[model samples]
Target: MSKAPNNQWWRGGVIYQIYPRSFADSNGDGVGDLPGITARLQHVADLGADALWLSPIFKSPMKDFGYDVSDYCDIDPMFGTLEDFRTLVQHAHALGLKVMIDQVLSHTSDQHPWFAQSRASRDNPRADWYVWADAKDDGNPPNNWLSVFGGSAWQWDTRRRQYYLHNFLSSQPDLNFHNPEVVRALLETVKFWLDLGVDGYRLDTAPFYFHDQQLRDNPGRGKATSGDAAFPDVNPYTWQRHIYDKERPENIGFLQQLRALVDQYPDTTMVGEIGTDDSIATMAEYTRGDDRLHMAYSFDLLGADWSSPFLHNLLQRFADKSRGGWPSWALSNHDVPRVGSRWGGPDCNPKLLRLAAVLQMTLRGSPCLYQGDELGLPEAEVAYEDLQDPYGITMWPEFKGRDGCRTPMPWDSTAVDLGFGNHSPKAWLPITGAYRKLAVNLQQRDPDSMLHFYRQLLHWRRSQPVLIKGEQSLLPVHPQVLAYVREHAGERVLCALNFSDRPATLNLPTGLQAAAVLDLPGLQGGRLQGGELAFEAFGGLLLSLA
Candidate 1:
């Protein structure tokens, strides 16, 4: 099938993130596959998402799930064949949903042929394909760079008598982007997917593409102060400033190369996953111009802060530093606890979930909604016995790992394994009883369900061009209320959200008039009296302004 005509559909678009393993299991193999995803395109389309971003499905050893790629050009058997992937793309496009696959270009599985050959001998043609450095005089790692998954980033290899760099698992070795051949080869792999009519790529660990070439020791800033927000405070990775290990200057040129390649295809784009101490700054740098990334997102919103000031400052910082660059906002994904659990607390109800959905959809950038988030699925509780993520396993009780968020999607509340698969052969991650109660089948029948609310919000958002491409300006409001004005082509919308659990009143900023109140869930019975907007707990209002 021919590609969908390019219209830069990503700008202000809603991209749904689907963790393949949890989305649907077609063959009852207890894993989600390409055919399964293909079969489920209707749900995404019906959800009003403009595109779907699939996590890694490339051939892998399954370490780090599919993030460790053994073969970039092929599909892993667990997911399905390359033909199945093609069928998925075709079907998704047919349903008017763009397909974006995750590309782990910074590293590859140790089992990858290139890594194997690189580690074989010093004189091998591919010896320089991966980062290989000599050990220090004391036979220790070349530097103090730490792996994100824990321990030293350098792993010793006997054959080459050298240590290779891996920002993640030892099995996932970092590729040497300094080698032009390596960059060329990775781009070729990317082109292979584009040739198959894939819409774009979600570049994983994007800022880690290049490292400090001099191999300087990463200067410690007392404690490891910066790490993934999803990680527990106990993981020491957060204490370091991470100067030498990632977000190096050389990465920009590589991104430009990747962007140039994708730009060759119509409407193709790239959204980078940037995790750094100053991710907003790096996000701006990576996407500052049209020559670099099409868009980028950091873990800023994915953290625990849900207050108005926090959200306001986060958006303001991005707007100030991005220098006209676009951003993609996400509240939850496979790597973190679900937002409902993170922000809603133990007693989180539908009112809070609906408020979150409204806030996320009306944000100033393209929004990515994780699978099951539309159903307001809280983070599942995964016991140690059922844990599958290595990062979570390394930290155990202190962290409890990411498996809580990676559980299989519950399709049917009453079906076996929550109707994830036909036979529901022991799922890779068990479905929790709480999650089963929020199953799609059940929510589909409820008009007030979070899922239905998301559909309504997205459909409404699409109709408002101002919401799609507006310039955002923060409005002065009470500390507990988040209010902002989005204006485009003379159309303006005042979005006010009450973050507290009790009634709050927001005095409209002087000179601003509510022309009409947009129809949104949870806004009924709200009153605008004497130039003051009264909101119940977790209430949200979107006002069309004169």
Candidate 2:
């Protein structure tokens, strides 16, 4: 059973995001399972993370990986039984780590019994449980809404001869939040996990919980294209403003109710994933009050723009807009490619990786570290034939999908399959690229390995109280340097990061004094003195101000 409530544990906490399908394989089934995760709980706790967020592990059709949940209450057989999940949760809690599971309440797999019953006939009790609309005069879709995966958001259901809304894959039908019954049912499902002792939920596409009742047409973006989006060049879903499709005003009341339920289990949190065009603002709005989300994360840091000027402006924008809400920052997740490859390139620079890790963990909000990021693993190069992601299959060549990042974790460098499993036919996804060299076993022995750098940074971060709940203020924006001062209880800590490959210097302003240079293990070659700070390439400075 969970211990006494500690509601404030999530504030500035370090959450390690684990992609369950790749973390470990205990059954020799090639695919990872709950037992695999339970066996590896010590790894997360040893890395000094306060919590772990498991990607969706519910019963699913595997169309969109585990994002398309079929059953809200049970674990999939492939991942083992509910007992297995219980064991994983118990083991995690024993290791002093909170467990957060992905909650896919916005939609359900077409294979769900509810969807099957609702589509059987219009007069069924659950007919309105999903967003079903009649075709327009031209027998076309109800509106111009497009699925985030591809083509139309509405699929014609031959049973009712009407269109059902699907913001993602066609197999995943959107739920109708307009129905009070639907809202109640979803909350009941969430309560199941709470009663089961999971710490919280990582709400998938949170803003998408409610959609416009009138089914209005989404307006197209006048000039914007998909150059810097999650799906670039291939997906047209980013061409529109996405106003009516998601982030409706009705969501606030629903979120409040959800929060109320989670609050009952004290210390439990709900961190929403906001992915609309205006994600930062939506994140702030969703988490503005204690009655809504406990915290929320946007795709702001998950993008390609890592320039100091860009980061400085982004932080300022978030600080300016966020009134009292909390945020969770993640540079990479199962959805995006590894930051090492995205930011550092094919043969990623471990120094830059260490620098990025420090920057993320030192940010104002709770930082979520994705699996393999601690090892500085670059994105794997999976062949087209080996691709399993439908998102990539739909938009091949230009965008090869998320399979590159979903490959199995490298546990041992000497093993033929990297020690993921023994007696298995083959790993679900090949352990390709140079990931073997960066395996956990190899890094465990190397004192200066990127893995060790993460352990050092995370362990040290826990000792700093000011970094936890401090008020963040940006320094004067520098073209190549991102700097901020976090103040709490009359104490101030300055964090300055150099985003350039070349050495950089910044002269401190009048009235500011660097009382002492704080020791940040793993991030080397940075000094602060004489009101003039100097940083080596991709270096950082953590100091106390006098």
Across 359-394, the per-residue lDDT of candidate 2 in tens digits comes to: 888888999999988888888898899999988888
- Predicted structure with the largest TM-score when compared to the true one: 2
CA lDDT for candidate 1: 0.87
Pairs that clash in candidate 2: none
Which 10 successive residues of model 2 have the least lDDT summed? 222-231
Q: How high a TM-score does candidate 2 get?
A: 0.98
Q: Residues 334-378, candidate 1, lDDT per residue (tens digit)?
A: 888999888887778678778777888887889999999988888
Instruction: Let me know the TM-score candidate 1 reaches against the reference structure.
Output: 0.97
Model 2 CA deviation exceeding 4 Å by range: 1-5, 226-228, 423-425
